[model samples]
Target: MSHVFPRHTRQAPPVAVAGDGCYLIDASGKRYLDGSGGAAVSCLGHSDSAIIEAIKTQVDSLAFAHTGFFTSEPAEKLADLLVANAPDGLDRVYLVSGGSEATEAAIKLARQYWVEKGRPEKGRLIARKQSYHGNTIGALSAGGNEWRRAQFGPLLLDVSHIAPCYEYRERAETETAEEYGLRAAQALEDEILRLGPDTVMAFMAEPVVGATAGALTPAPGYFKRIREICDKYDVLLILDEVMCGMGRTGSLFACEQDGIAPDIACIAKGLGAGYQPIGAMLCTAEIYAAIEAGSGFFQHGHTYIGHPTAAAAGHAVVSAILERGLVPRVREQGDKLAARLTERFGQHPHVGDLRGRGLFRGIELVADRDTKAPFDPARGVAGKIKKAAFEAGLICYPMSGTIDGKTGDHVLLAPPFIIEDAQIDELVDKLDTAIAAAV
Candidate 1:
């Protein structure tokens, strides 16, 4: 009987005692490869002495300080580092505890920015189906995951959700990739026109859709069209890069590959590299100026906002990523990872699609390759694959509902930036066995 409640009540998971590089060791001395970086969080892997020392130093110097009164050195330094490396026009940063908090803050901040600009009527948010922002009410409303928003629908805000850019399942057979990309992106324009652009506050989408839709990357010129649509309507563009950003996609920011800059961006997971619980919301100068010039305060604050210890960890983790040239390393190694996955799964009957960018990859599981039909949700394919991989001493992120909220399945692979070539081979081998057993 454990007093600490777990994510799953009936089954108590393993007690991880230690982390070394890309492996987590259970108390029983069993080691498991961290193929998904623990939900794409640990980019620096485990046992980073620099980040560990930074956290300890900050704890000793100043553990906690309310942002209402004082801002600590670590917090400021972290913000500066993030801003310096962030996308163009993104000038200010707001620190939060986790990805969800960062997303909620970005949503509310976007709304408040419009209010400050005397456009309070622009409060409606638009997002895409098969997308995920966060779990909080506002964030959940922005998210389009059906299972997550099912019963809670009544409590959620009336945010409109359009189609996602999932080429494997959503693209028509006759359409070219570019044509599919344009058609998929055009959905946003259609929705905006139907809703009246002035009433729409912002359009949010993940650069590479994570969690709910696996690691779905947009097609060529997809984002450019979306950017044009937003600009045409004076609607704000908010890219939720919480999962695929911070070098997960082989670039510092995943949007860099799309060749567009968002009005506001929410990034996490890789930001602190699991060294600490940290997330950040960054905005353009225009958005910041609206709040700075009017009322002069962004109405938001979490108890742990700008926490010195988390900030110190974030600073150290980010510095370690840049200083060690990990970003380029991801690009180089990610190519190998993708090549290996393609070679292994490209012909596998159950593997409907093997796609993604950089370390963040997705393997779509299907019942029939010809039709791309998903396995029955009742089959529990995702959970079974997860358990099988764990038994084989591998830890990969397997998710269901890759197509709709209840239909498809996919395995999301996000091994640490420090993962070795040998480990990559071991991961694919173990995954091969796991998928065999699950299907």
Candidate 2:
């Protein structure tokens, strides 16, 4: 009798009634540890009184104000805070509803920047294969996950996908990690030349590949070379930090660790920390100045852009992260979690790789560790793990298609920044049980 549509048609999920710290409680009173932070969204956990009070205070005074007619205080303050802490050169913030909107706006802004510069021919977008940006049309187009794009192929834009900086499977035995990184980055330059440098506008990628490829961290100097190539070709580097930014990767911005900055950056998930629906697309001062000097308009907008209540919530979440010293805590707790995972799964026959930064981590499963071969797609290893974990009162993100878009599986763990040491052990224990049952 339920009319509400679900992501999967055949199964009905338990109704979540409440949240307590890092655990979610269903109507039946089962408490599930939020191991994946609900797709890496709840960085501050479910109940933070400071963020809750901020939302309440803002809503009592002012909730919504159309950005066209006015700019609210909360929105302005949040924007200022974000830019102040953002990567060097990124000075402007365009608030949106969620990750897809942030990335979609980034794409449009990139296109508009080129157009304003009188180079309308620079329209092609290049992204990495096995990357997931967002779900909207433009965001989806920029994303290279084949299975997600299979049915929507006709609706997607023509985007060229280069190989990802995946060190594990792609690196050759002959090359050192640094050598492999440089070789991987060369693909971007090669693709830009093949497509004609003048025809390419921007290159988009996640600093730590999530979802589609799990938390796939780039090798040393990988992003540095990417930054260099983009600079040399006059191509904009658009980093999608939707699921990995906002201190999720131990830095306010994930690219900071890579020692590079993007021409444009997209962030969400941890921004509002599941307290509100909010995302922001930040750009370099140069890009913002282009529109300011020319059209004085970005020619793109959403009705919910600059929503005050969401802004207030985001501001509080970020302030809590910075003021309460949670970023370093993420690094500290992340080390513990990583060590626990390695200790538990390092010798497991099916566990192929354990990788990621900060609280964001990934565990790739394989049929043969020696050959690094994936489990057969028909085995549904990821799906089974997810089900088993959930049944055991744990919530983790496990996805298929970690290799291409079909033949691999990985479990992504992104627990809250406030998680305790005992909780870390609990998370790994539950995950170990899940993997054992699944594989």
Best-performing candidate as measured by TM-score = 2
TM-score per model over all chains: 0.99, 0.99
lDDT of 1 by residue, 152-244 (tens): 989999999999998987788899999999999999999999999889999999999988877899999999999999999989999999999
Give lDDT: candidate 1, residue 70. 96
Candidate 2 TM-score over all chains jointly: 0.99
C-alpha lDDT score of every prediction, in listed order: 0.93, 0.96
lDDT comparing candidate 1 with the true structure: 0.93
The residue pairs in collision within model 1 are: none
Specify the highest-lDDT model's number. 2
Off by over 4 Å in 2: none
